[model samples]
Target: MAVVVGVLAVAGALVAVTGPAVLRWWRPRPASADLIHGPGMWAALRPVLGVAETERRRTWLHLPVTVGEAGARIVLRLPAGWASGEAGTRAVDAIVTGRLPGEWAAHWCRTVAAPYVEWVRNAAPDRPRELPKSVEWMQTGDPLKIHFGETPEGPAFVHTGTATPHIGVSGETGSGKSSILYIPLVAARLAGWLVTVIDPKQNSLTEADEKSGIRIHSETYECVMAIAEFFVSMMAAEKYNGRKYRGHSGPDSPVGRLLVIDELPSFREYVAAWWKYIIRERGFPPVLVWFQLILMQGRSSNHRVLVGTHQFSLDVFGSTMARDQVGTKMVVGEVSIPSWTVAYGAGAPMVDYDETIPGRGVISLKGRRRKKTLADGRIERAEEIQYAYITPQVSDLLDACPPAPAWWDAGAMAPWITPRDLARADSAAAVKDFLPGGRFAGGREDLTPDTDTDVQLTQGSMPRSEAMSDVSGPGAVSGVGEGLAVADLVEKVGAEGIEEQRYTIAQACAVGIIRKKPGAARQYKSAWIKEGKPFPEGEMIRGNASYTREELESVFGTPEEDADSI
Candidate 1:
């Protein structure tokens, strides 16, 4: 009887130790959480297991390391060698994540030589983050620092000054993506900041009341034109000053200027839909090129961009080397695996990201000081937050913030007005100095986009450097120049003409059209010259070679031949 009693005692101890894990394995929460401690991760790291942590060894690069088991984490100073690039990073993630208990994961701080991957076993508290309670304590000491949300730790804020200037917000529809912008925009407006809005949806925040020092652009085509004009205006102002442009302070402060672009993807769709017609056919508008420039150099001038969208990726901002330039990026509402990847970018480990709570999600900011990882289950890259809910009453408070007495208007001039906003002698004289006959709104809200008019390359005079000047010749402006022998030579040959837009570049390339950006159209001239063929339609605009699609089709085969080859 004594021996049997002892055996039962041992059996009871074993059941007590393993029962919860066994039960958790048998019936995981919501079915998806079953693989929380992914055993496959261990198997996935098998190839790299030779040098990484193994059954008996913790040495990496043959160096000694430490191991400690805390409440829920196996704190291991293991091989960071497996964390080299993206593939190696994933392998290390498998190792770190294998240690967590609940549906939680782990991440190493952003350093290669850093010796440890942080882990904690606690199931992160699943309560929704509430913003209304924290509103009274919201200390926005810096006007440039705009408060948008709240984390369990404190109020969430982003600086839009010289240091960290732009903010990017992305989430799915009804995911509070647009809701996140209300506080910042309203706060900035209340602070008497000059606000420019591009509202593609034309519903919310589309109307700009001058009483509040706000201006808005609504149509798709108008937005492009406005962006281009703003870019040129900045350049012109910088040139006029004979100094590097600065917007926030000094005598010529553009500090009052702030641009908010909602639905950034809308502009990108416009480009994708009309690329062939816009570029080779009708002198490309340079939308993404100039827009990115604004994001990059606009900081020095206090020109800020607060942009929001449904999806966040490189293509969304037209290939943002300026992505880092944006400074603060947040994926709000119930964050998804895909959004967490694109929003925070690669190598950011996401644990406990199943945030379905409204106005709450994850955010990553540039230039933040390194903080010690807490046992509370938040990593540096994947910091969770609850955005300030812009309740109607709170909006009433924001709406009450008065506008600045001084105001600046982008549409103070007319479309037909001369480049300098002064009287011009005549159209012919204007032609000599200015590249006229293109759409120029100057931020006029009344103006609609004119597809018939080409985009005006610049607002004011672009000084003709010998580099900026093109002469009429095979090497220069081929078949394009007033009073040139090339015109008569073209007449004698009775040149074959075909309409531009004969084939999209893909179709053209099917029959072999070699053209890339900046010169996607110009390459045709070079190709013709290479074959010792005459391209009688190559023209030079502002020193860049411009080609009409009609001319390209005439030289290359027609659309029928191009399509047939495809």
Candidate 2:
């Protein structure tokens, strides 16, 4: 008896360490979580012994990793896909066995039966692209495709492009809410639209800092209000100016089509004034609003909001805005809270979701189908791209024109004009020098011709060289005279557009779109058309309105074109 006990103890110790290998035939091998590198032997074996050979690990565990759900029986090779949708409802409709607790049964349905529902979603065919490029917050070059569906609340696609529409995507933490912001932002930038980011949480706009397209702001109250007012003022001004696209905007007009706000609830609580202003003054094209949660009442004709939160409750839903405005409600995870039923719309049935599945976020389409995973995995969050350098080529392109008043440092420009109303032109002849199709009156915006039009134009008529000259400047032009005041010329020419155009030009200059000459007042030097080739359009030939340069110095009174080069 003593000898037998010693042998049994040795066998038990061996099973503790090596039992997983024997059970490998039944258990999946070497599972990993994002937080921890490898699985424990006991965890591996427990599932093997609990499940039969036919059952397999249903979901891939990444983050938010957990031990197995209670009383769940795994099954292999379930009939899945669209055909399985109805069949699944019929086949797995067993009442809970008395042996298992209610909570255990609930968890089992989520873990074991939920995959069939996910397979149904995956089985559906892909949809066509709705927007030009979906925006991606993730570094992975994927775009968020805008989609819609049919339901009693209204049609799904009804609010596709506009912000007056709002959507609700809810899930627990780390379930891909932040990763979702990138797709719309990328789409906005690629479309040449601007983004006004409102992130009360500092991390919301971190990825956008060095990005080319949008503007990001972080602060409480004051800064937020200022941005809100700016958007409001812009929308109102667009209407006030009656500025339609008209198929032509003269390369300088305010044409904004989108607004993006991330972390909406914190922004609302901390910067309520800004939030109120944004909703009330919804003149900006449309908004893509995101949040852990949202409770807003105001609605504007031009704005659309997309709210995301972990909680699905009527009490938190608050205002009528949620019920009326929320055209789509996507719920993630199993039905834990009964309050969610109200938000799903009247008489909508509650359904369970498999919490163990990775990338599985429940989306409630109109009919309230059971919660399932995306066809792809959970939307992974991406790291932000770093932009360290600005090339000189981009610098020259912006130098050709005067920038807007808002960006001009008033103290820097104190010698020029009032800060309240900064003007582009400080001199008369400066107008004729910079405006394209000019040497005529009324700057670039006019059809009016002047007496100096007869003078051989400062810019030559050749295509490549002329375009280059326009970019490079009067210095390269043959017979060009000195002291032309190119800066004054650019400013004068820039004044013709509406206020927004003027402001845009100023901001472009400030942002380094164009290069400016140092030590000279508003001197136009070169435009960044392309690398190495500055100002290929035309050169500033300094012959007066009278003299068409014949032999260079004889016509312009200056020695030679190159001599005047600044």
Please tell me which predicted candidate would have the highest TM-score against the true structure.
1
Please report, as a residue range, the 10-residue window in candidate 1 with the lowest summed lDDT.
474-483
- List lDDT for all candidates, in order: 0.51, 0.33
* Distance from true location, Cα of 93 in model 1, Å: 18
lDDT of 1 at 167: 82
lDDT of 1 at 38: 34
Local accuracy of candidate 1 as per-residue lDDT tens digits, 23-51: 57565444222133334444444456444
- Summarize candidate 2's per-residue lDDT along 1-566 as a digit string, tens digits: 99999999999998987797676745764443322422332234324234343533343322223223332342323332323354444333231121122232222223445342211101233442232111212222221234222222222222333232455555556655554444444444444444445555655545554233334444442223323333332333233244363334443444333345555455455544433442222321111121211213222313334455555454334444454455555543343555354445334444443444432333444223334333332111111111111122222312322332332111121111222222222131122122223321111221111111211223222243333443344232111111133333446545865332221222122222223221111122211222343322222233221111222222122433435564
Candidate RMSDs in order: 20.5, 21.1
